[model samples]
Target: MHKEVTIYDIAEKLSISASTVSRALNANSLVSKKTQQKIIAMATSMGYRSNTFAANLRMQRSNTIGLIVPRLNSYFMSEVISGIESVTNDAGYNLIISQSMENVDKEISNLKTMFNNRVDGLLVSVAAGSNGLTGFDIFRDRKIPVLFFDRAPHGLTVPSVTIDNENAAFLITQHLIEMGAKNIFHITGHQSVSVYKERTSGFKRALLAAGLPFNENQLIVTDLSEKAGIAAAKLIAELKGDGVFAANDSCAATCMNELKLQGFKIPQDVKFAGFNNDLISRNIDPALTTINYPGFEMGKVIAAKLLDHLSHKSDLHSSPLITMKSELVIRASSNYKP
Candidate 1:
């Protein structure tokens, strides 16, 4: 293995004191700009790597933040993480991310790992099956700032940022109602999640407002996977609803394909609408109509807010909720009338 370069080596090569080299590397204005540049150039040429642990201890701060998400494979979650990285990297912070795969046990393990690493802050989107915030007590006790985005824990004091799921779902449902969809069906994920529960509530509210009956058989709850979408399509075929609102675009696309195979016409016999406005929404034949939840923007906003709080130590007690807007995109899937 090659020998690691250090500040002492840089100082020796530059014929300067190690203290001067350290100050220059730390960007201390006490050192002249010319000297700092010369030292940095030499350090870069020598392949000198800063010891993050040592630096963190000396500064009493870790420049790394921890991020925990239910899963890492989805397009929406990936976009959100990308946006977070952009903002955190610009602010001179590193992100250590982990996925729970929607398991509560794995989510607990990830939280313990993040706490052990002593991250400056944490960002989390709790697992769907996570029943409570018991695992997050370590952060709360240690006074480490934690921010929740997207799938947040309900009734928590931690700062959270999310779009109004109820309003968005209500709007989509109203759109279907306006299209003469008397028997509308809603395909949703686990109702334990605030997002899914709120969406279901919004669907019910819309039905009541329109004087339409909310049929128990019309509501299908599943895991929001492609297979679930296929199953939902088959189930919907059996039930035969005029309009369908899926919790997400991937499921909607799958259902759309399956429904077509089962001899159902798109937006002719049955209209469809989905959420998240994901790429699949545009790629699917007879493009999916969905709600634009702005996952990427939500990430950027949450990251910026967390960084600001870390830097300023701002009082979070005043306002705990940061809500973003969601817009309904009327595409071919839901646009039945000419």
Candidate 2:
């Protein structure tokens, strides 16, 4: 049977006292930094592993953070998580990730689990329902730092990292208007989510600014899926709208395909645009016009903020919102000059 390597073995190999080795391993200030580095190197060469359980017990910290997101399947969501992992891993921390699957009940349950695990901090992208954050009070009471990103909940003054959704939406709508599209239809996800609500507001602001009627009939809300895109295209065909702005690239791409099948020409018959510069947006016929949302950057910002709070380097109360930048990417789909 193989035996586990210990600090005492490392000390014996280095001809040093076990107490000195222990102090070096724990990064005690009493141990000189140079000696600590040498001891660490020797420990690594000797295949010694520190007892994290004991270390954590002494420090009263888990060295772990909890992350909750609406879903993990999308490219945007996955990239955000990857960015977070990159930052946390370099900082000697681990992430415990959970997906709410856009269900309020599941989100509440995940929150409970995070609390039970005694995570050092929490990062969240809220789910779609109004009751998605029923468990938020517990974290507040426990004095745990919670930072939200992307689909943050409204009315919660918790520090968050997000882009100006309303501004981005307004830009896209205005671009379609500038392209000589008079009747523009807007397709989006559930308005309960803050991102969708802000986007809807932006769309309305643009239409009203252009002296166009705010037609409720032209707004379609769905799950932002490919199926939703198909349905939205069918509705637009019936309404005979000149342009469309779907909330996501998947829906936008699928909507374009559906519109083409229905004998509509891209940008010629009906101009199309979407949000989130997803790969599907670029790969589609007449690449989609979209807003380049900085998902990965948002993730890095949120992780940095949470880590700063944990390290006492920043105060969450001072800044309630950390806004990232997003830009409009014009493509062939919305550039037809005819």
Candidate 3:
């Protein structure tokens, strides 16, 4: 087996101090350019490699930010990740990303790994089944900055960056009401998730405000996946509401397509609305009205907030929540009667 090569070996072979070799390898200005070049060439010839992890540990920093999300297989998450990577790479920081797959145990395991690695900070969009910020107290105990985005829990001191789900849902419902929807059924995700819970609240609020009866069966709780959307369609058809609002586009589009197959005319029979202006919203026969939740922009802001705090440019302790702007988009799916 080949012997491992390190800086000391290079220094000994070149007849120089290890400090000089170290500075040269690290590009310290203290080492002369000519000497640094010689050291580099000798190090390369000796097959020596830099130990960045050990070096970063000695400096009490990782230059790495940990990101924990619920899942990676979605357009919204894809855009968010792209935005985060763009900023973090430009700032010379690395991201250690992990997904919980909507499992609380997996999320906890990820958090433990990030803590052990001594990440500079952590950004998390909690899992769907997460009860609350129980396992996350370790970061706070260590004074490690932690930020939550999108799917955060209620009553959190850990600052969050997310759109106002309640307000967006309320607006969507209100629009349907103004369009003469007497009964608006809402398709949503697990009620344990704050975003979905808030959306439900908004839907109910709008219905009550409009003096429309809020039916218990009108609110369907599902994972909001493609299959869940298809399954919910049958129940939606039985409920036979004049308006249907989904927490996301995937479910809304699938339900719309399924309802269409059942001979239901959109807008003319049932006005459809959804959150997250995903591509499917546009591809549907009559474009679906939705809330334009800016995942990419939210990602940029979340990374910037934690990075700024780490760099001592700002503090986030006082600011509990940062709300991103979500615009209500109107389309052919939601047309009002004169």
* Per-model TM values vs. the true structure: 0.84, 0.84, 0.85
lDDT of 2 by residue, 1-338 (tens): 87887878878888989888888877788889998889888887877754333356457578889999888878898889888988999999989999989888889999999988878899999998844357889988878988888977798776888899999999999999999898999898898999999999999999999999987987899999889999888899999999999999999899999999999999999999999999899999999999998878878888888888888998876888878999999999999866
lDDT of 1 by residue, 1-338 (tens): 99888788889999999999888877777899999889988987887764432346456577889999988878889889989999999999999999998889999999999988878889999888785487989988888888888887877766888889998999999998887788888999888888999999999999999999887988999999999999988888888788999999999999989999988888988999999999999999899999998888988988888888888757444577889988999999878763
> For candidate 2, what is the TM-score?
0.84
Total clashes for model 3:
0
List ranges where model 3 is wrong by over 4 Å.
Answer: 1-55
**Weakest lDDT window of 10 consecutive positions for candidate 2:** 49-58
The per-residue C-alpha lDDT of model 3 at residue 315 equals 90
**Top lDDT: which candidate number?**
2
What stretches of model 1 exceed 4 Å from their correct place? 1-53
Better of 1 and 3 by TM-score: 3
Q: Work out candidate 2's RMSD over C-alphas.
A: 5.9
lDDT, candidate 1, equals 0.87
The weakest ten consecutive residues by lDDT in model 3 span: 49-58
Q: Please give the lDDT score for candidate 2.
A: 0.88
